[model samples]
Target: MAFFIRWLKAASFLETKTLILDASSYIGGHLFARLGTERAVATYYRNPVGNVVYFDALSMSLSEVVKKTQDITHAVILIGDTKPDSCASDIRKSHALNVESIISIIKFLKERHIKPVFTSTESVFDGIKGSYVETDEVNPILLYGRQKLEIERYLQDYTVDFTILRLSKVYGVSPGDGTIFTSWLEQIQRNETILCSYDQVYSPIYVEDVVDGIIKAIDTGAGGIFHLSGNKPYKRIEMLEMLLSIASEFILQPVNVVRCSINDFGLLEKRPLNVSMVNDKIVKAMGLVPSDARELCSGMIKKFYTNGAMEYR
Candidate 1:
């Protein structure tokens, strides 16, 4: 019995030792930022007991990424979702710049023989319908959605092993600009009125839940497309109201909230009226249960304000 117990302990040790992460993209940057300095460690394969190594893609080349890929038993690619283009020519032109960045990374990882775990957006589905499943056909109207769909096809065609996580709208505070949460936090902090779309519906995943889902997927070796999203669907206006209510409860001043039609925004592409995704596959496969949006938002607000992230906005 003692020998059996020792063997089990050794196996447990080995399991923890084999995982390594190659976080070279923006999503990687944000994920590690949340995981923080304490959990950071060296190569998982070499150390046999370490956590994750945060590799910055900007500083490293494709060769370096390949070297790390060969060294680790498991790796993850964290890329950000593409942003929407506005009707204005200048805005559309500026947003178009991201397409090259997205394509380049995909090409780089492919060349390195590193099968990446791709992160996509629910915007890929035209908001005309809701309750999209894994088998549903994707029809993206927004430029960002189209780009992601293109990449998804590219990866599916070329890569031998890959898992696509089509994420719902994400909410959380980060250090720099970008993210709807950051924008909303800034607007609320300044007591500025924020315009939200009433017609558009989306399910929001808390940043922590996103990270957890990713880790779960990685650990389980589950491949193919999965939707990492919130279980509940809420309209843009409803989300704003919930945010305001949470802020007020936390002693933060309420900001004026305005509802606007999607057409008035002069968006370049049509947005799907519904962007909610079903989470049963991820939940059943990965055993991941996402937190309620309200609770998640409340936690994020507290973390931002108490941790001085609010000051940055």
Candidate 2:
């Protein structure tokens, strides 16, 4: 009995006052539902609020459910469904309305004075120049960017304690399948001509780093807009080459890669050439230096291929 009691104490240390994250709507959608992120986040969530009072922020009302949240000391929202290729109608009919609905949630948190943490993206900028700061001009070039920017603007003068962690290209493996990472691996294995664009340049952060930075923000009570990304910026081709090289080394097979321009792809949305954000603010705030792009990318590759992915044999 004494040994069991001591063991219980050690186990209980990992549990924090319950933290809530809505995902019924956001699940099976974006990077949030991916295996890498879900696995990394499991450590931070002991007795998660979703295990108890379940709520879909987009489908159901956040105001009612947020209040029903028990022992909710802190709430973190990690949901963003829209992207560059999202059609105008999809943005208008769904993504835009989702943002407006989240406002009611913000008000509920304000009533109880619970500081909310929101995830923003680097797409808010036009990417005319790289190494963007928090105060850089936000001329969003895509529908997704417009949606994120709209939310940022709504929170600016609300007299609420909130922290907006604007993220870069977050790379990780999907929980189920068909993530960009998996797709690249599959294409490489099949010896398909991978048309990697040379126009885009951005600092892609690892999912673990982003999750760690978020936990740090929650712990240290950091607020306001902060950029969290890898230490360096890289072109898409450069990054893809690194990924291919790693795969080649692992599977002992050469890859067929094709260098292409962004214009040739005929994409619906105009992608920003340089969406990388300066992580100086987040580094300073957390008093920690972030890993280099190569290191993060390599680690992700290894993890995703550990048990064999959709394509990596």
RMSD of each candidate relative to the true structure: 7.3, 7.5
Query: How much is 139 displaced in model 2, in angstroms?
Result: 1.2
Tens-digit lDDT string for candidate 2 (1-313): 3223323533565433323354332321222333333222211122232323555555655555544433344456664454567534476655644476567667766665556777778989988988899988999887878788877877787845678888888765544444455568767657677888898888877665776777677667677999988888988888887776775557665666778887678878778888888888888888646766566556657865676654322
Off by over 4 Å in 1: 1-26, 33-61, 68-70, 86-113, 173-182, 249-254, 300-313
Stretches of candidate 2 off by over 4 Å are: 1-18, 23-53, 67-69, 87-89, 173-180, 250-253, 299-313
Candidate 1 per-residue lDDT, tens place, 1-313, comes to 3223324534664422211243334445445555443432222212222245444333444454344423223345443334575413344443343344445655665554434567788978987778888888899877677767877887788665667899998776564545676678777766788888898888788777888887776567677899999898888888877777777765546477778976678776656789788989999999998988776667777876777764532
Which consecutive 10 residues in model 1 have the weakest lDDT in total?
A: 41-50
Candidate models: Cα lDDT each: 0.64, 0.65
Reference-based TM-score of each model: 0.73, 0.78
